[model samples]
Target: METVDEVDAPQVRQCPECGATVSVHARFVSWCAACDWNVDPGAPDPDRGRLAAYRKRLARRYGQQLAEEIERSGQEARRVGPDGSTVLAFGVSLLVHSVSGGLLLAAGLLIIGGWHTRILPVFGIVLLIAVATLLPRPGRLPKGAPVLYRADAPRLFELIDEVGAAVGTTGVHAVALDTAHNAWVSTYGIRNRRVMCLGAGLWEVLSPQERVALLGHELGHFANGDVRSSFVMHGALRTLARWYYFLVPHPLDSLLDLCVNTLVFLPRWAVYGLIVLLDGLTLRASQRAEYLADAGAARAGSTVAAVTLMDRLLIGDAVEAHLRRASMTAPEASGGSRGREAREAAERELWERLAARIGSVPESEYERLRRVSARRGHSVDDTHPPTHLRRRCLASAGPHPARVVCDASRTRSIAAELAPARARLARTVIRYNAD
Candidate 1:
């Protein structure tokens, strides 16, 4: 099946060997995941036009107004929490904590029984309160808030099958691509189907190969089930984790947590402090995921192509500048200008880091290309890592790519490519966390 990964290949909907949903992800793809019948994109829906095809690759479903609506709707959706998943989780966390607390309470009683050893009572009481306070509670995302998805581009649907087959994956449920040159896969709707977002910004900037590389990385997310798993994980944890990202990253986040819990009178701006913490974590994850996705991208599009895409992302600071402008354009009247400003600043910051990590192209070549993408109107942010670190991982990566081509999803496939390497990578990640 031709998948979302192979952009250069022709889009066909019919199978020559059998009449099935022509697998678009791979050539000679014969089966359809949705309906067992084979279908092909090449067979061409008589209604689709060459012009529509071209524009579809570049335009959005609705203008900015529609996007804002979708953004609005999505926020409400994230908060639904599915019949008290949050409440259930909070209950579970409480139960877990209560049991431990009960044990401590008993210890405290025992200590008090032997008041001669006052140290045990003091320690038990203190630990008991601490665990009880840390217990999870039902958290809410304001009564009404929306989580936004990437722009839905018109042409992104073209890559769905191509990307799927290239990675041996299947099914992109929702079509979304914007007029901008960026393309990404997101999920929305209760159905939990794939929502593809393509920006004119992305189409204008990335080379076809680079686009294919990204598609493969996204499909890796999908075919690998990273997308849905992320959704579920986030859904379950959102309430419990309201204060989590704040506790984790950086030495100071823990301090921030102490102030919030102990003082009991946290200033609103403590949110700003958490933002600072999350900013750092996001930057780190972006850099890390870049290497992983790049590894997958390489398998999707030769190693050389993957490296080149990193170079392209780095050289393309104009993208950052554009996103900065777009963000700035959001009505200042919106509830949170400072938050917007922070996000814009963060994007620029990430784009800059991307340059430092992915360094190999001559400065002169890099500058020239960055300028060119700037001219075309594709905007990128600093979220990507430096190319050098990424390239190094790939260069030193196992000679044989993982058999499953970076499968993070639950697909039955050949033995995972480079099991030892995968295990090492997982351990490396764990140790990094241990730090």
Candidate 2:
């Protein structure tokens, strides 16, 4: 009654126990509908020696490159004659203003001269409106954002401070925890206040030592002066793009809108090009900053820990995918609390599945992950380099044990502290979605 199916093709297989047909789609594993007998062909055994050698070569080659980048970052940091991206962003902003001003001036002269007076003023107004709309406002976090603050999680705050001090940068103004599976540090408020954001989902999966490495990498941005420059450059470029697109005249608008759109079309097009140019000029520096952060992680934790952190971070993607898939299923007759309980259960399940899979990732699969990451190195607009490069760089730096270590009890306490905030944040999310 047993039958075999080809890999990656939908084929019918007969159950050995009950002789019922079951459709199998995947390659690595298959199952039966009517019987529980294993129909798995199992994954092939990987050559551990070859994988070890291959990774060793990658570490040796890319590690040298990482060392060069570290030197470059240090040299550039010292030489500071206005950051290249800042200069480019400013220059582009000035160019946009100049072009807009020039057009308005010409329109004013035309109005004063009584040549095409009506048309000129209308065109001038459109350009002015475009300029006004495009000016960059200070960035702000979303309204009713779900965040766990310092007062709520003092232990986590202490952990952050301890990690920051060890990494030689302890100027944190605030710390917030969210549901995301990524950690970052950014500036908030008009006064350029620095804040650290840690992901609760990420915390759930990582060991205490790995958390230290994550904190180190994020805090390292401040130490390397990446925060302010990135905020300025990214903000400026985004504003420019906004302004450029705002100038596009819609057909539904009156004829004047079309005419105005025509007048500024070339300049708007030029703005797009300038954004592309700025991206190219700044990409290498951005990638180097990522390497420096990886080095920071290695310095704060062990090289093994840093690399493991990178691998574990990849698992977050899978967790998100599973969550999305689970959301597609029809809900049972569940009320509010029941729905919330169900969601929490799903999250717990996803974390367990992700952790188990990551914990036992084979060498061959790890190699495959590295290749995929390397192939998709930083895109033109990406702020970080490929995961493989980061992993390689951390491996190259060699291992350094963490300066601060925490026990399982400490980690659990932090999670417990976040419980109330997590509930509040969940309510905020539900309210937002309802609205």
Candidate 3:
């Protein structure tokens, strides 16, 4: 069978905007090479929504500032320390937790004093509920989440550990796999055990060195001194968000309900304002931490590998769309003994098909994606700075040799270890699309 990158013929077309001749590929965007028309076709404007507009402003203001700073200082930009913004973030966090504690104390006192007055207990119960709603809860992994322990995937764990060491942090306790096209590291449960979550969609497309870059970036979070990720601040942010959720008025059915909602309106907006304020205070520091983490990526996987990883991320939308198309078009088996065998065969082939599809993307397509991203100021999400800025920063940094190298033999071993997860996630994608 012909691969995705193989085109029998190039279709010539005129650019609607510039009247320039363009060469169109079968599976890639066609644009006028001279005029650069349609280079970012159909991409939504990054400055669309209110929150998005705010984030875009932040990205421009801080992203440019940090990029310039990095250009001037080089590796010195990686050293982040307590500043006014971070201190304010911590202060707000303290205030939020204190409010929660006060509510708990008041509820306990009222409940204990209920022996003297029946109404006191009723009010205490209400206060207790409010306290529960306001309290910061530990993060929990979703039920039946696919988790890989060190024992089960020694080679993979070793790679992660080496990356972690390079990034100046201890390795994560566990690895979690999911179906999204992203990767992150978060502390889970009351003990705050660090777990690295890898999305199968993203993982399958990365080269071994890029995978090390990805790991270095994530593990760097623990060492990068992101104030927002600190326990106190993270909990406070969650608590305020929860408060806003509960305080928001529901649909009213009666006059009493209207009155109750009216009373809540101010508090709801107040919590929202606080959330915004806290986010603003920590925004700069967080963006800086991300850049520091990117430096870690370069340190662990070499500058070239890290920069290539960023380039790959620029085409994430294309990758996801390809996967979606594959999922939707996967053949369904007819009911019978033969059907089960056919289904299993298709499941087993899913990863291979996806790998081939992604691997077949040409260098020109990647270059186009980077140009589009630069134009769009694209990012993985609002939390991240623009991809163009990140790419520029990575390129500007001096090249460093890779600290953790995964040879072909170890890479194959790691692949073998992940085979079961690959199979399970492949079936999941197929079943989801079928439904």
Best by TM-score: 3
User: All models: lDDT?
Assistant: 0.42, 0.60, 0.83
- Going through the candidates in order, what is the number of backbone clashes in each? 82, 1, 0
Model with the higher TM-score, candidate 1 or 2: 2
Instruction: Choose the strongest candidate by lDDT.
Output: 3
Over 5-98, each residue of candidate 2 has an lDDT whose tens digit, in order, gives 2224466677667787865555323445345345323342242453233333443344446556645544211213446665665576566556
lDDT of 1 by residue, 1-435 (tens): 743334424354753455454434332333443443432223322325433333322222112222243244432101112234334433544443455457667766856775778677777677666545544333222221122222332233434465567666774765443333355665555555665554433433554556567666667556543311354333423323344434433334677766655553353235334333333323332333334455556666666556566556543444545444444443333336775565444433432332333332334345334333333322233333333444444545533232223232311121122122222322222211111
What order do candidates take by TM-score, descending?
3, 2, 1
Error of 2 at 166 (Å): 1.7
In model 3, which regions exceed 4 Å deviation? 7-9, 14-21, 43-53, 74-76, 252-254, 432-435
TM-score of each: 0.37, 0.67, 0.92
- Cα lDDT for residue 286, candidate 2: 55
Q: Which stretches of candidate 2 lie over 4 Å from their true place?
A: 1-133, 227-231, 247-261, 329-364, 378-381, 423-435
The residue-level lDDT of candidate 3 at 253 comes to 88
